[model samples]
Target: MKTQKLTLTVVMVAILVVMAYIPAIPLGPVPLTIQNIGVMLAGAILGWRNGLLAIIIWLLMAALGLPVLTGGSGGIAPFFGATAGYIWAYPVAALFIGLSLQALTRFNRVNFVTILLTIIVFGVILIDLSGAVGLHITTNMPLPKALIFQLTFIPGDIVKSIVATILTLTLRQRFTALSHA
Candidate 1:
């Protein structure tokens, strides 16, 4: 069981890293990437503990100067850069998603509605808000402006969350070990 957990966690981390490397649109301090989908999946599938661990491990890899983040930009620079707020929020968001799913599962309500709501709340809104906050703090952007900027990410985030939800549900059916406990 431990080995399975470790293996699945590593796979999730790898998936997130690969997703990061997909083509990104540079948007000043915050570039748009699809990695958030994988992050949400990690939380919903791996649960809070392993999901958070996966994000932390991936962040550590980037901090260690590996080309594992968006646009091949790695190292500790991003952590302290304008993306810092979002970076800091990744594990927290993952943890929230995982915890939400675990609780939902306990109620036998791990269906589309619950999964979608959690992803929209914890995964989409939480991450985008954190990124906006980071951008505001790091770049001296006004708080309102930063928040408005986050609005532009909503459509994309919604789409990504939907994708993550489908993937989570599918994977959960096939791999009981990966489903939220």
Candidate 2:
């Protein structure tokens, strides 16, 4: 069981790396990257703890100067940038998302609505909030302006949440590791 969990975590990390390699649409401070889907799926499919570990591993790699984050940009520099909050929030979002998924699974209520809501709140909304905070701090932007700017993140996040929900539903059925959660 431990081996399976570790293997799944590694696989999820690899998936995240692949997602990051996909070109990102650079829009203002935060670029639009499909990598958020990987973060959401990490928690939704791997369970909370394992998902968090995988995210941390990915972050550590990026911090070590590996081009693992979106846009092939990596280093400790991004951590102090306006997008840092969003980056930092990935593991946190994954933790909560995984927890929500686990609860739903335990109650046999892991449907589209439940999973979508989980991803929307924990994955999308949470990251939005964190990104806004990062903008506020790094750029000294007003909170209201920061929030307004963060509105740009919504459409993509919604799409990512939907994709995550569909992927979670399918993976939970076919993957025993996810099914247990």
Candidate 3:
């Protein structure tokens, strides 16, 4: 179990790293990337503890100057920049998704639609809130304006949540180990 967990954690970190290399669509100071999809998958598939660990590992690497963030950007500087909120929120979002799924599973209510909605809600609430807060603080923009600015990310985030849900459910069906306890 330990070995499997370690391997899975490494795989999740790799997924984040790979996703980071994908070109981002820049909109103002924030850029949209598919890295969140990897974060969602880590949580939904690996559960909270392991998923959080994977994200932490990836973040640490990025902080060490590895190109493990969107558009191949990394370093601790990004963590203190406008997009810092989104980066900081990754683990929290993953943990929320994992915990929610685990609870749902306990009651045998883990349906595709349910998981999809849960991911969307959690992603929007957690990631957006954190990202907006970070933007507002770093740029000294008003909170409302920062939130409005985040609206541009909604469509992409929704699509990523949907994809993450489908992929997670499909993978869960094939891998019993993915089912959270």
Maximum-lDDT candidate: 2
lDDT, candidate 3, 19-97, per-residue tens: 9888998898888889988988988888989988999899999999999899888899999999899999988988988
TM-score of each: 0.94, 0.94, 0.94
Candidate 1: tens digits of C-alpha lDDT, residues 50-79: 999999999999999988888877998898
**Number of clashes in every candidate structure?**
0, 0, 0
- Report lDDT per candidate: 0.89, 0.91, 0.89
Native-to-model Cα distance after best TM-score fit, residue 55 in candidate 2, in Å? 0.1
lDDT of 2 at 81: 94
Worst 10 residues of 2 by lDDT: 172-181
lDDT of 3: 0.89
As for candidate 1, its clashing pairs are: none
